[model samples]
Each structure stands twice: as structure tokens, then as C-alpha cells.
Target chain A: MKYAFYPGCSLEVNAAAYDLSVKAVAKTLGLELVEVDDWNCCGATEYFSQDELTACAVIARNLALVDPACGQITAPCAACFLNLKKVDRLMSEHPDLDQKINQALAAGGLKYRPGSVQVRHLLEVIYKDVGEEGVKARVKRPLTGLRVAAYYGCQVVRPFKDFDDPEQPTTMDEILKWLGAEVVDYPVKTHCCSGHMTQISEPEAFEMIRRLLYCAQQREADVIACACPMCQLNMDAYQGRVNGFFNTNFNLPILYFTQLLGVAFGLQPRELGFGKELVAAEPVIAAKVGAA
Target chain B: MSVTVKSKRFVDEVIEETPGGHRLRDCIQCGTCGGSCPSGAEMDYTPRKMIALVNAGRREEALSANTMWSCVSCYSCTSRCPHNIPVTDIMYTLKRMAIREGRVKDNDGPALARAFTHYVDKYGRSFEMGLATRYHLLNRPFAAMKMGGMGMAMFLRGRMAFTPSKIRNIGQLQAIINKARELGGAS
Candidate 1:
């Protein structure tokens, strides 16, 4: 299966591991991902709050570039997925927005008719297209004895409920289970990671991150598997900071679901961008997948 | 402050300007939004109280409240609101209104908002390196120096680019922004 992939800005920066592991997993699964040429940012969450029209226009510009044959697009980041899916939804729902956004697109010598393409989150593609059996067939190294907490964050399922139950998504859980890792009860799985909240108020953002990590730790999760770049960055990079703020010593490693899946597929850790995270996954993987 | 005729205009304009503005009228002053909010404790006024303030023509109080910036856009309040009032969207509108009206009490939120928008406005995509530098430089100079350790770590990992990766034919992007700006709220 081929998809036009829009690996938004975070993939190039903080979430490089997610990008690397996504590509690695795609290769192992035999799924073809074609990069969306000349893609711009999805305008993230800030832009939407700043100017709805300009944000829609920014996303519309990228939607207009999808190859018709590969019109089914996948975004790895939750924020990007939401922005793209939202703009598509709103453009169709509001004729005024549709006309105005298209007007902006026309300035770029492009036009995107609303609903011309289907937007899916990367996890949705991996779960739907690859299937459990497809993943089960390729586990060279089963992740037995490894317990994981699946972190869905907010944007993937909230406000829109088709991919999974918004309140309690289980796609990532099922994927981890298929990869032979024990999935733990993650009650706070759908909670926000305070996206960019770290910048606005460090203490508030730290508290939000602490809740997710503390829950995962309480449930004895070896690592937290996530689908969004922003979620992973916050959990992984700020894990130490959260521990520092709260006077707790939690050493949980936060890995992209694809990174763990890559390990199970027997891909090398360095090749999957494993060593770059602040809270290293080396020790956790060594005890789990490496040993198995 | 007393609810004067001019303050009533505040309610009228919000109702007129926002897409979900009419939904605001449907709110029953329910505290569900405040209850569900992750950052509600930090807000000067809770989401529930903000709605009531808006309806009561307390424009300054609603806009000046830390509630607007404290909202992390988690969608928890919006998704769980019994009235289906787009509380989060309303928050967004309030934030923009705050910035537009220059009533923002806290600089961090509005500063970050402008930094992100300005970065995107220039590069067509966010430049993390540029955005962080610019935001801290302009807002918190001392904090910029402290971010050195994290910056060095990010640099070593090749996570950030010193230079921005610009989209080809960025002139088109500029034109699109200009057109969107010209069209104002409708665009």
C-alpha cells in the first residue's frame, strides 16, 4: 500500500526517532510511503487560535499537493493529523471557509476541492492496512516480559471518533499486544501532554507530564509507546525534569510505537533513532526485546 | 465593573465574530468545563465562570483572565461540555481577542503565540531553532542563556537546524498570507 506522507516539522526536529522508526517499520511491513513534495507546516494549534482563515489556508496549500493516485494521506504527528483532518472537515462543513481557503490556494496556483483526499493518522494506517496478522507474521524478536503503556494523547481521537473510541482508544494497545508486549491499564492515556505548554508555564506542563508518567510508572510499564511527535517529545525529553520537579526518581523510557515495533522486527537500534532520546531506551530494550 | 451598554457590545461582537459564538448563548453556566479542565486550577477564572462573565458583559474580566492562556487546548472541556458548547473554540476566540485588544496580562502565552505565527509567517513552516531563540530573546533574555544545555543536546543529536528549510516558491506562500489577511475574518 502506498501513501502520501506528510511528516510535519516535529519529525525533522525533536521527533526524528518517530520519523526514522516509521520508515523502518514501513519497510519491514512492505508498505510504500511517498513523501508529499514541497509540503509546509500544518500551522499547528497556535495558528488555528490566531486566525482560523489563515490556518485553513496554510493546511489547504499542502492538501492541494497530494498526488492524485496516492490521495490517501497519512500524518504521523497528532497535531498535524488534527489540523489537516480538521481543515478538510471545516472546509466541507462551511461553504464560506471552503471558498476562502480555495481562494488562498489559488494564489499558490493550486486548488483542493474539499474531500478530494482521505486523511488518516499514521497509527490508523499501520493498524488498518497492516493488520494484526501482518504484524504478528513479522516479529523476529517478540517483546515478551515488556509491559507498555499506550499514550494516545488528545488530537488523534478527540472531537472526531471514527478511528477509535475517543475516550478509550485501543489501536495502539492492540498493536503492542500483537508485537508480544504486555499492554498495561493506561487510564490517563487520552489526557493531554500539555503540547507546547512547557513553553507557556513549565510548572503546569510538568504537572501534566508527571500525571501521565506517574500513572504509567504506577502500572509498572517499562516504557510508554506513543504515536504523536509532540507527545513523545514531552514525555521523553521532560521525563527527567518532571522527576526533578516532583522529587521522584522515575526512569521510564518513552519510545515511539514504531521504535518498539522496529525492535521486534529485529531492526538495529541506532538505525531506528533509538539513542537520541533524553531518557534512553537502551536499558529497557536490553532487558526485554534484546534478551528475548 | 458595572455592565454598561458598551459592555453588552462585547457579548454581541463575540456572538457575531465566532463560528461557535451562538453556542455560547446555550451555556447554562455549568461548571463541567472547569471541572474537566487539566489546568483549571491555574486559571484566574474557570471556563464555566468565563462563559457567565461573557454573558453578563464582563468583557474585561473574561478576556483578562489567566484562564485563556492557561488553557492548553486539551479538548477535555469541549468534548465533555453537556451543552455541546465549543468551549475550547470559544477559548481560542478569547485568546485571539485578548491579543487583538492588547488586554493580555501574561506575556508568555501571547508571546509564544506571536513567535509561532511569526515563524510560520516567514518560513511557511515552523523553525524551532529560530522560534525558541526569538521567543526567549524577546520575552525572557535570561532564560535564553539557560536553554544552552538543552540546545547543545539537541544540536548534537541533529534534531534542530540552524537554518530554516524553506518551501520552494515561498513567494506563493507570501501571496496566500497576504490574500488571507486582506480577506480578514471571512478568509
Candidate 2:
């Protein structure tokens, strides 16, 4: 299966691991990802707070850039996925806004026909296009003993009903199970990671992060497999601070699902962007997925 | 005792500012948003109470409240609101309003938010290192100093970039942004 891939800004820099693993896993699964040419940022969560039109217009520009023949564009970053999906949904729902946004796009010699492209999260494509059995059939080194908590974060399933159950998503869980990993029942699976809050207010943000980590720890998850880059960043990077603040000893490895899939596919950890994480995945890798 | 009259004008202005907030009037005073908020304890006004402040035309109190900055935009309240009130969107509107009116409290939320916005405006995408450095140096240098070790780790791991990846046709992006600002403000 092939789709237009919108990697967004995070993939190019901080979340490079997610980008690498996504490409590696997609190649392993025979999914073709045609990168959208010259795509810009998706305005993330911060820009929309400042100005609605500018934010939507920026995302609309990327939508217009996608190859229309592909019909579907898969965004791996949850924030990008939501921003792209949101602009498409809003434009279709409100024609006036669509008209205004299109006028802005027109300046760049682009025009996004809302509803022409189906914006989907990468996990959705993996679940729907490449079914669980399909992924399982390709697993070379099964992650049989590893326990995973599928962290959906907030955007992927909430505000609008997308691919999975918003309140209780299982696409990640099911996929992990397919790869021979143990999927734990995490009640706060849909909870917030406070996204950029870790940068803004550490005390408040750490509290929320503490709960997610504490819950995953309680469930005895070997690693928290996440789809969003921001979630992975906050959960992994601030783990030290959260531990420092709460006076708890927690060392949870936050990894992208694709990275885990890459391991299951017997791919190299470095190729999957393994060691780039703040919280070390080496112990888990050595214990479960094998030596780096 | 003074009577609390609902300020229709303030509520209408907020509703007009953000189309996503059209359902503000539909709020049934349900505390679901407040109850579900993870940072409710830190908020000066709960989402439920904030909406009431808006309804009652307590514009100054509502706009200046620290509650809006505490919002993480997790969509928990928006997703679970009984009346389907776009509570988070309303929060967004409130934040924008707060920022515009210069009512932002002395907090890291607004400081960091502006830092993020500044990078997006300049690079057409966020520059992580630049944002971190700029925010720390300008807003909280001591905290930045404290986190120097963590920064070094990120740098060594190549997680932080020294430069931003620029988008082609940046001029076009700027034009689009300028047009949006003009059109957006005209409304």
C-alpha cells in the first residue's frame, strides 16, 4: 500500500527517530511512503492559539501540495495529524472559512479542495491498510516477552472521532499484540502528556507526566510505545525531572511504535533511531529486542 | 448582596471571536470540564467557572485569570463536555484574548508560548534549540542554568539541532501569514 507521507517539522529534528523507524518499518511491511514535496510545519498547538486563519492556512498549503492521486495523506505526528485533519474537517464543515483559507493558499499558487484528501494518522494506516495479521506475518524476531503500554496521547482520538475509540483506543494495543508483545491495559491511555507544558510549567506539567508514567509503571510496562513525537519527548525527556519532583525511581523507555516494529522486524536499533532518546532504551533492547 | 447579571455582550464577543466556540452558550454549567481537567488544582478558575465568568460579563476577571494559561489543550474537556461545548477552544480564545489585552500573568506559560510562536513565525517551523536558548536566556536563565546538564545530554545525543530547517518559498509563507493577519484582524 502507498500513501503521501507528511512528516512535519518534528520528524526532521527532535523526532528523527520516529521518522527513521517509520521509514524502516514501512519498508519492512512493503508500505510505500511518498514524501510530500516541500511540506511546511502544521502550526502545531501553539500557533492556533495565536491566530486561527494563519495556522489553518499553513496546514492547507501542505494539503494542497499532496499528490491528489494518493487521496490519503498519513501524518505520523499526532499534532500534525490533528492539525491537518482539523483544517480539512473545518474547511468542509464551514465553506466561508474554506473560501478565506483558499484565498490565502491562492497567493502561493495553491488551492486545497477540502475533503479531497483523507488525513489519517500513521497508526490508522498501519491498522487499516496493513492489518494486524499482515504485520504479524512479517515479524522476524517477535517481541514475545516485552510488555508495552500504548500511549495514544490526546489529539489522535479526541475532539473528533477518527480511526480509534477516543476514550479507549486499541489500535496501538492490537498492533503490539500482533508483533508478539504483551499489551497492558492502561486506564489513562487517552490521558494528556501536557505536550509543550513541560516547557511552560514544569511543576504543573510534571504532575500530569507523573501520572502517566506512574500508571505505566503500575501496569509494569517494559516500554511506553507512543505514536506522537511530543508525547515521546515529554515522557522520555522529563522522566528525570518527574522522578526528581515526585521522589520516585522510574526509568520508563518511551519509544515510537515503529521503532518497536523495527526491532520485531529484526532491524538494527541505530537504524530505528534508538539511542537518540533521553531515557535509555538499551536495557529494554538488550533484555527484549536483543543487542544493539 | 449585588446581583450577578449575565453579560451577553462579552459572551457574544467571545463566541464571535472563535467559530469553534459557537457552543459556548450551550454550556449547562456542568462541571465535567473542571472535574476532568488534570490541572484543575492549579487553575484560578475552573472551565465551568470561567464560562460562568464569561456569561456573567466578568470580562476583566475572566481574561486576567491564570486558568486559561494552565490549559494544556488536551481536548479532555472539549471531548467530554456534556453540552459538547468546545471548552478547549474557548480556552484558546481566552488565551488569545489574554495575550492581546496584555493580561498575561507573570508565568512561564505565556513566556514559553511566545517563544514558540516567535520561532514558528521566523522559520515557518519551530526551532527547538533556538526556542530553548531564547526562552531560557530571556525568561528564566536560572532554570536554564539548572537544566544545562540535560541540555548537554540532548546535544550529545543529537536530539537538539543547532539550526532550523528552512522551508522553500519562505516569502510565499510570509505573504500568506501577512494576509491571514490582515484578514483575521479585520474581522
**True contacts preserved, each candidate?**
0.59, 0.63
DockQ of each: 0.60, 0.61
lDDT of 1 by residue, A62-91 (tens): 888999899789999998998899889888
List runs of model 2 lying over 4 Å from the truth.
Answer: A289-292, B1-8
Worst 10 contiguous positions by lDDT, candidate 2 chain B: B178-187
Clashing pairs in 1: none
Summing lDDT over every window of 10 consecutive residues in candidate 1 chain B, give the lowest-scoring window: B3-12
Interface RMSD of 1: 1.6
Candidate 2, A1-292: lDDT as tens digits: 8799999888987889999999999998898999988788887888877778888898888899999899999999999999999899989988889999998888777898999999999999999889978898888888888999999989999777758888898999999998999999999999999888777778888888999999999999999999999999889888887888889999999999999999988899899998999999879868876664
CAPRI-style class, candidate 2: medium
Error (Å) of candidate 2 at residue B89 is 0.9
